[model samples]
Target: MSIRHGLLALLDQGPHYGYQLRTEFEERTGATWPLNVGQVYTTLGRLERDGLVAPAGEDGEGHVFYAITDAGRAELRDWFGTPVRRDSPPRDELAIKLAMAVTVPGVDVREVVQAQRRHSMRALQDYTRLKARALAADLSAAGPDPDGPDPDGPDRDLAWLLVLDQLIFQTEAEVRWLDHCETRLARHRPAPAAPQAPATAPQASAPAAPQAPARRRGSGSARR
Candidate 1:
């Protein structure tokens, strides 16, 4: 996600201070990607430098407020008009790891892959549990009452349901991918071999000719 674009979109609504922009951005995006105060300021600075945004005025506290310029509005409109290419590129770390796994040593690669899978699985489990809880709460809140219906009730909050759906879908996909990775790693690992004993030096054979040599030496001595 482009922070610059996101901030520009937010500024298109109206002029806002840096802190307000940061807060509103988080709220609109369901706080998915956290925004640092510094990042917001930095993006604002870039937008101002590029003539996409300008300082509108100051608030009571003298903090500079920013408004999207005509150029920024055009940019935002252009962004919205353009279709995002879902197939633009793959930025998945797991995919990168698997691609390079062949070049890495067996144990080292297996360890890294397995570690990633384990972490992914754990994250999936946590997300699943959280989704379940959210669903239960949503259901309870949306449950039909025997006596009366809420005119301004939980049924109105379909926004959270949509967010939950996206979260659950992503988590389930991650879990499936992790499982596939684990299976592939297991298949690629070589089977263990039986251990062998250490090799020893060969023993020398007895000297059959030693007896003849000794006898010749003794005869020679006696003769002398």
Candidate 2:
């Protein structure tokens, strides 16, 4: 996640202390990434060094505040304008595991797929439940105009709803992908060959006189 750009975007609005930045970030992103206070300060330092942000004095409580610079504004504009690049996606551990499971010997790829599907389904359910609660709360708070849009209102709840929806969709997608992997594995896996025992044919043989090896010459002479 681009925490740097995220901080810059937040700073674009106004100057804020580290804790404030972290709080606002979580509020907007629904704490999905959960920015740490130390991390916020660290990011602020980098942004200051990079001329994207600057120390804008301190608040009444002596908390140092940061404000976005012209450079940061330009970067934020570009970030909003540019489409997210999908050529390189974040590495998915489950996908890697399934990929190896299907290709490696002694691996039960079907079991792997089922296990991951269960985990993803559970996560999807959790997110769905969270969404339901959020929707219910939003409706309760809105009263009669529950479905009406809020033109000039705080959107923390809405932000959380969007985040939860994204997680739900992502988890659902993973479950579907696991099913796809199982189906594709079945098609790709070769059939196990039947085990064969050693073939031994019984045969009748005629008895024959066996010739013994000649004794050593020295031993025969001694005996004679």
Candidate 3:
């Protein structure tokens, strides 16, 4: 999600206006992470300030264009060469929600898990459908033997498919995680009370012994 690097990479291709870069970025990424015009301009301004990009003159219609500097190209190259590090994972809202649900009093964790599972499942289905359509479109555009090793050239279709596949896989993993949560919650769930027997005769020999309270599970002990 480094918009800076993304804009730099796009500028490496050639000179482009803010709007043009935004359009191409969305097209290549299948609009998975949409960018607003203001965001694009803000990133561009930062790039210009950092000497990563320079003004490439305006078009006939008075649109300011930008071109990547040599430094920007170097940065883009490094970005492409390096693997994305996950040592510090980003905060996920769903994970936080689930954790809070389990800890908060009077909250049904199972219901929260089920709701998330439903949403994730729906998203997975949608991504699957998009992948199917993308494959069909690629095949139709590639003519016969689309899987051949010989790539024609830079293929934006392939770029979009790769991103779409990543999204689908991520959604599938989320659904599986939600299922695991549901199972774990069920295992920890409190047992139901047993039915009482009919009333007996009043004359009891000795007083019944006092029973101890059941130990409640602590919120701190609930992992995820």
lDDT of 1: 0.77
For every model shown, what is its TM-score relative to the native structure? Answer: 0.65, 0.77, 0.80
Stretches of candidate 1 exceeding 4 Å from the true structure: 106-108, 129-164, 186-188, 193-224
> In model 2, which residue pairs have backbone atoms overlapping below 3 Å?
none
lDDT (tens digit, per residue) of candidate 1 on 76-116: 99998998788877497767877787676654665666687
Give the residue spans of candidate 3 off by over 4 A. Answer: 144-154, 191-224
lDDT of 2 at 112: 77
* Candidate 3 global CA lDDT score: 0.87
State which candidate, 2 or 3, has the greater TM-score.
3
Candidates sorted by TM-score, best first: 3, 2, 1
lDDT of 3 by residue, 29-94 (tens): 988899999999999999999999999999799999999999989889999999988998889999
The clash count of every prediction, one per candidate, is 0, 0, 0
Top candidate by TM-score: 3
List clashing residue pairs in candidate 3: none
**Model 2: CA > 4 A from native:** 144-153, 190-224
Leading candidate by lDDT: 3
lDDT per residue, candidate 2, 1-224, as tens digits?
A: 89999998889989999999999998888788997799989989999999999899987889998899999999999999999899999998887887787678998877777877888888888888889998988887676565685652337778888889889888887877777777777788855678889788887687787879978767746543
